[model samples]
Target chain A: MLQKRIIVCLDVRDGKTTKGVKFKGNVDIGDPVLMAEEYYKQGVDELVFYDITASSEKRGIMIDIVKKVAEKIFIPFSVGGGIRTLSDMKQVILAGAEKVSVNSSAVKNPSIISEGAKHFGKQCIVVGMDVEMDFSKPSGYGIVINGGRTKVDLDALEWAKKIEKLGAGEIVLNSIDADGTKNGYEIKLTRMISESVGIPVVASGGAGTSMHLADVFNEGKADAALIASMVHIDGYTVGGIKEFLNKENIPVRI
Target chain B: MKIGILNYDAGNLKSVETALAHLGAKYFVSSDPYELAKSDKLIFPGVGEAQSSMKILKKRGLDIFLREYFKKGNPILGICLGCQIVLDSSEERNTKCVGLVPGNSKEFSHNMDLKIPHMGWNQVQSTNNHYIFKDIPNNSSFYFVHSYYPDPDNQNAVIALTDYGISFSSAFSVDNLVAVQFHPEKSGPHGLKLLDNFISKTQGV
Candidate 1:
């Protein structure tokens, strides 16, 4: 059976791993490359690094951090933030990152998703969607861009469908409202998009405990869960979380 | 021993290179048949769609070189796209591949109630005692990310099987040639061990 994945997210700013509460007031934690390798050693299934400052500062993801992580951690990892063009995707992949994610940039120009998928296989392309609850929107959720600083009028469900059609292999559904809240994943929103798309959906943001992951995977029907704070600062080990999920009958790589 | 990593316009070739460097093995990346011919063993690591990859292989004459190399009974290891293109045909782009293995690549059915690109880690069960799986335990999880899988016409060619809505061949072996649908280079410690086993097999251990 295909096991449900547990991905540890590292939000890197200026090469150091940082974590913010709902995308605000991020505190420097540690070195991203070191944190990545440590998480890999702790039996994490995959890793995702978001260059938090790239999009706002109008710069590329720190390639050196990517290269260092690749050399140390031998697992499938993705690099997101500040990826705008096909060349950016190429540079990240060639530097040894398995996948390149485009979130804010994909909203600005949807063609980059198709072009990246065409140039590199769709398997290497990931589309990250930062969504916030909005009763006014058709899907009851609106898409936000530029690291959640700018809210687009686009409906969340519609954007999810569009990106899958545009050749996005997977969708990382991050909830702005639930982000860093430590409550749980956006089950209603995550399940809505998961059922709507044919591609794999990774539920991101607001993972506080192992039970939360169990809820997302069982109730939300998420193929994977992207977590940060639970394991980053809450003193939860990736192995411990997977053990709990395994006990709960969720198939996780232990 | 010298190992040649076939570079015929595939994506993320650097991961394989770094894996080899980490193992302290002598390896080179080349599309030229002459350079690859000099290798004691060949590691075909690929990431892309089959149709375009096959086209590039034909243009660089790597398709012929690989076919001839397999005929000579030299050890060859195929990973991901490398594993699929070794088959005679593929459902992707209806591509006719290298024909080294008696099989064809197939796309997972959408009607099966599963994701298209089955990404992430899953258990790969060893079907038989092939030297390639030497020290690797049975049902060990490896990273996978593909919609299509290799289905060999000959059942004996299949060395391992995996389940994802359906049980399918995840690894195949034909004499000196072995191939797997998962990426060993990106699969962490166990994956590195698998690559080391491949190297040990080439050394006749």
Candidate 2:
């Protein structure tokens, strides 16, 4: 049976992690590598790093950060933010990221999806969708890009189907409507997208507690759940989340 | 011990190199098979299309080199697509593979609901006390991402099995050769240990 993955997300700006990702139980936490190592020790299934800086100079620095983190963590991790071309994707992969995610850039030029998938197998490309619920749209959700600054004509469901056809290996569905709310995952939206596509769906955004993650997996049928704020700010650790999920009959890699 | 990490300019080379470095094991990554000649053992790791990947191997003359390397049978570990290539042939793009093991690689039946490339962490049940799994725990999970699996003509060679939609061979262990459908370098501590096992055991033998 495929185990439901609990991925820890790190928001890195310049070279350091944006906000201090503290582990209540562990005191040895300062840098991204330390935090990542702490999570790895707890057996966090995977990790995701978003290059919040996204500047040309900072991206080169981010590559160094990726290399440092890769040296410490063994599991697979994906790098996103400011990944514009095939070379950008290759840099992260060579620096040791197993996958590269594209959101706004991919929206602008959809060919990057197929081009990337062709250059470096479909497994390497992830189409990350930031979706916002809209009653005006037929699917009740619209694609948002540029950090929710712009909205596209594409319906969430239609885009989900299109990205899969374009040879995207996975879809990371994040709800702009429920993001940073500390409520729970948009189960309705997640389920809708998860069921609509053949590829795996990673439910992201709006996770406040471990129970919220379980809900996404059990109800939304998400192959994986991306947790950031809940674990980052809240006094939660990856081990704590997995332990909670395990009791709920969600097979996490404990 | 000196280890040869055979790089085909494909998947997980850096991660594998990082894992080997963490182990404090002496290793080098090179596209040239000749570079691996002086090493004690080899790790064949690949991730990508089987058809195109096979062409590169033949282009580099690695297909010939690997077959010769296998005949000597010191120790070589094939990972994911690298593992599939050790078989007789693959259904992927109707590609012929190096036949180190008696088997053929077949794509998992297109079970639409279940993901085609079974990508995630999953349990691996050890079938026999294979040396490659020396210190690893039983029923431990390893990371896997592949649509095609090797159906070994000889079932006894299968060292481990994992079920996605059905029971499939996740790994095979035969004399001086071990191949896995999962990525050990990406599979965390247990995975690192599996590589360590392959290293320590191969050198001792």
Which candidate wins on TM-score? 1
Candidate 1 lDDT tens digits, A70-169: 8888889999988899988988888888999999999999999999999898988999999999999999999999889998889999999999999999
> Model 2, range A1-254, lDDT digits (tens) per residue?
89999888887776767643221122222467787888899888989888777467757888888999899988999999998999899899999999999998988999999999998899989999999988788899999888777888888898899999999999999888777777989999999999888889999888988899999999999999998767666789888898899899999888
- Which segments of candidate 2 are over 4 A away from where they belong? A19-30, B202-205
Model 1 C-alpha lDDT versus the unseen true structure: 0.91
Candidate 1's docking class is high
DockQ of each candidate, alpha-carbon based = 0.89, 0.83
TM, every model: 0.98, 0.96
Q: Mind giving the per-residue lDDT tens digits that candidate 2 earns over B1-205?
A: 7889887776658998999999989998888878877778889999998888888888998988888887786799999998999998999998999888889999887754688789999999999988888888888999999989988899999999998888999999767889999999999989999998987884436
Q: For candidate 2, report its TM-score.
A: 0.96
The iRMS of model 2 comes to: 0.9
**Model 1 per-residue lDDT at A221:** 94
lDDT of 2 at B45: 94
